[model samples]
Target: MVGVSSARDRISLRGIRVTAHHGVFDFEREQGQEFVIDVEARLDLAPAASGDELAATVHYGELAQEVADAVRNDPVDLIETVAERIAAVVLAHEAVEETTVTVHKPQAPIAVPFDDVAVTIVRGRA
Candidate 1:
């Protein structure tokens, strides 16, 4: 097996778009909107690299589906909660040592004119 020295060596998935009901307001919840998600998983890659096998490392395609499912299937009131949930799901993979999840709410119910609203969280093994 190969070892990973730093979290910098990771598998990253970005701009996963999903329509879901998540917000603090009833209107926002009732009228689901688009959400963007980004995920980075840190794990050992030596085994996969040495063996030249897909099983040795994280399967990012499947991981992306899992993240999208988490966003679509679960409903929450805050983007923070969404980010946490995504992190938890990514961390659940046995190979993952640490993960960073970012949930973007472009259509947030803020009165001010802003480009975007997002929450990012990082979680790692204990």
Candidate 2:
């Protein structure tokens, strides 16, 4: 098991929209659709806050772009995989100790009407 950190500080980026080709069906892969991603990263903020330095903190705007890029990359069959990819990206930041990622598929291929479908994952450093 990985040792858990008790960090309370976090930076959350929500509702990041991206159009990507990812699904089980042929049409889904060929036509593509939109996906919404939410990411929450946990870290120690005291260094950045006390020093008032951008370098000490994770650049969220850059993070968002990286998340979007991950989503738009290689197509996968499950939103779970996408969520995992997003988590990996967030954890790549040296300051991020833990991350929770949510990948939302609003237009999922369900017979009945639904608002959305999503997969959420929480990851922490070892």
Relative to the true structure, how large is the alpha-carbon lDDT of every model? 0.89, 0.93
- Best of the candidates, TM-score: 2
**TM-score (C-alpha) between model 2 and the true structure:** 0.94
- What are the RMSD figures for all models against the true structure? 1.9, 4.4
- Candidate 1 has its poorest 10 consecutive residues by lDDT at 1-10
Candidate 1, residue 48: lDDT: 74
Q: Which lDDT tens digits does candidate 1 get at residues 1-126? A: 444575557999999999999988899788899999999999877777888999988899999998999999868899899898899899889999999899999999889999999988889988
TM-score of each: 0.93, 0.94
State how far residue 15 of model 2 sits from its true place (Å).
0.2
Q: Candidate 2: lDDT of 98?
A: 96
Best of the candidates, lDDT: 2
